[model samples]
Target: MSSKEKLNDAFSTISDSFLTECARPLKKTVFQKRICRLLPLVAVLVSIAILLPIAVFRHKSDLIPGRWTLISHADETVRKEMLVESAHKPTVSMSMNYNKLPAEQAEAVGFSPEKDPCVELFAQWFYSQITYDYRMHFSLFQKEAVDYSFTSEAIERGFTFESALDKLDTVTSHFYNGIKYDLFYSLVSCKDLTAELENTQGQFYKSIVRCGADPAKISMIVEYTFDDIKLIMNERFLNTSPDGERFNFMFYCYDGHWYIFETEMENDFSIDVLGKDEDWLSILIVPQECYGRVVAVGRGYLLLDNGEYFMTLDELDLKVGDYVHVSFTGFQTKGRFIADDGSTEQKVTCNNLLTVKLAEPSTPSEEERSNE
Candidate 1:
């Protein structure tokens, strides 16, 4: 037989066998008839069960766009009102001395005028030192924590002004609450470029921050020209080593638009990285009374209220009746040390001294001793 005829025969045989078995059961009267009647109902219930979840999901999905639109409109209204209020406030402008080096003092600091032409040479030196130190302490690119990765070289090669602007558009569309908003304003507010050229090494663009309440809070928008960017890039490359000592540059490109190239600096000085103060006397102290009435046993340590003095726990040098300040950390209480145990080997009582004064005096009502 031909292949098609063989397949047809196989299907016919299976159907005939199934029908014969079904007929045999139907021959058993009421039982067969009841199953035959319930089969159609069971099929219908199974179809509905499969389709129910899909129908519900489709219904909810249809409502999402409308819900998002309402939320967005509400947010825009609040932001508009805040911007208007912020604009009416008086703005204060203070020149931040970016270059803190004195021109006359450059000779004493071994700064050769030819090598370091900038007058603020000392400030530059300090800035470079701090920046390098911070980078060394903290690796700029934490690869383990990052979701996306790129290098400064890749950013430089891939990026163009047009591309960056396009990426900025995409960024603003998605991340309107962050840097995108700031960049959008910066581009829109780029006014006259009549400022006299100071440095030929880089091109500079500045925009006035119009949306902030305080001038100090307002950011001065500046974009370093390509040459400036290249200089910074070259310096970074030379400073960074191949042994993972360098920072990774991450760039976001949207619709062929490239955003700013940012590398995690080794030392992010903008954060607090200072160590704890070791000198006890120089530490600022507060007294226990400053904190709410001490319900349980509490201890305070010696603190230096004055900026100059240093305090130590050495019993050999410090004695009872010596004037000193004690500060307890959590309680926010600072007091003068009045008395101490003469022996250095034992635990001393600093709380009972007369010289100790509460940084914040308790209200007289709370100060009254309760007659128990």
Candidate 2:
């Protein structure tokens, strides 16, 4: 009676305890399933709250605050064709004058007397002048000039021949400040030791010379034109050629002025100098008037009363309530121009037309807002 009764009592107590624990867990499981079903709805509401602000911020229409409409050309066929032509164009090579230095001067600019001493002096001098001013330096030869001319060869290219010529002229002008005609004239008038070799018209000697200050050290470059060679020797060498490469013919800035120490030229054309990078952001500004608001610091929009006018940011330095003259391209809208005639809708030329200010910021609403 003792062993059997004790075993049965222990089994019954264990069964009751297990059933009570299972009942609590079952209830918890049901509650967790219900929460899982509602989680998606809560997540969707949270996402909506996060996206609303972004949507409102991007809602730009009619040029209103928090809304903007940018008008850009959708057809880029012309631009693409122009870009392709530009990419495939061949580069132009410029020839420098090494014979500008005579045989004696060539030895002075690190040019070996054993080698072609005549041109070595000129090459040495040219290299020194170029390396001296890295920012404004142009290689004695510009590859872009050739490249541009090559690109312009394609007749179907977007820009006209005149336009291409204009661009080339613009780029070349950046190399030197003097007028092209005057420079050419001066080169023709210069006389030097090489000029003594010229017998008559069209008989020219091509030489490069480096002549500056020191007689021992010199720079070397190549020369092809007799006039350029003579100009260098007459203006730069003081009518005398250095004896050996011991002279420093390279120009050094002394007291903010460029002074040549010595001179020489190389006979070979293998010397390489890096080309100048193009200025992409070059722009011309024109004055014009348009309606714009000083909405915030450093922010303003020039609005044209004529709906079709559009201008580039590069064309004008605009400010709030400042009257300016502007020219733009767009369609025309029929509008009443307040003139001697009271009020009559007139067909106005809008697209790509020059606009003169009829008045400054005169809208009552804009004035009230400004006061606020």
Residue 272, model 2: Cα distance from true site in angstroms: 28
**lDDT per prediction?**
0.22, 0.25
lDDT of 1 by residue, 1-372 (tens): 999999999887786778867776554333211100111111111111101111111222223321111111222321000000112111111111112234433333333323321212112222222222222222222222111222232245464434433443332222101000000000011111122123222122111111111223212222111000000000000010112111112222222332221222222221211212224312213222221221111122232323111122222223323343433322112211222321122111122111333334433444465532
TM-score of each: 0.15, 0.17
Among these predictions, the greatest TM-score belongs to: 2
Maximum-lDDT candidate: 2
Q: In candidate 1, how many clashes are counted?
A: 18
lDDT of 2 by residue, 131-193 (tens): 122212222212232223233342334544446444544433232211100000001111122
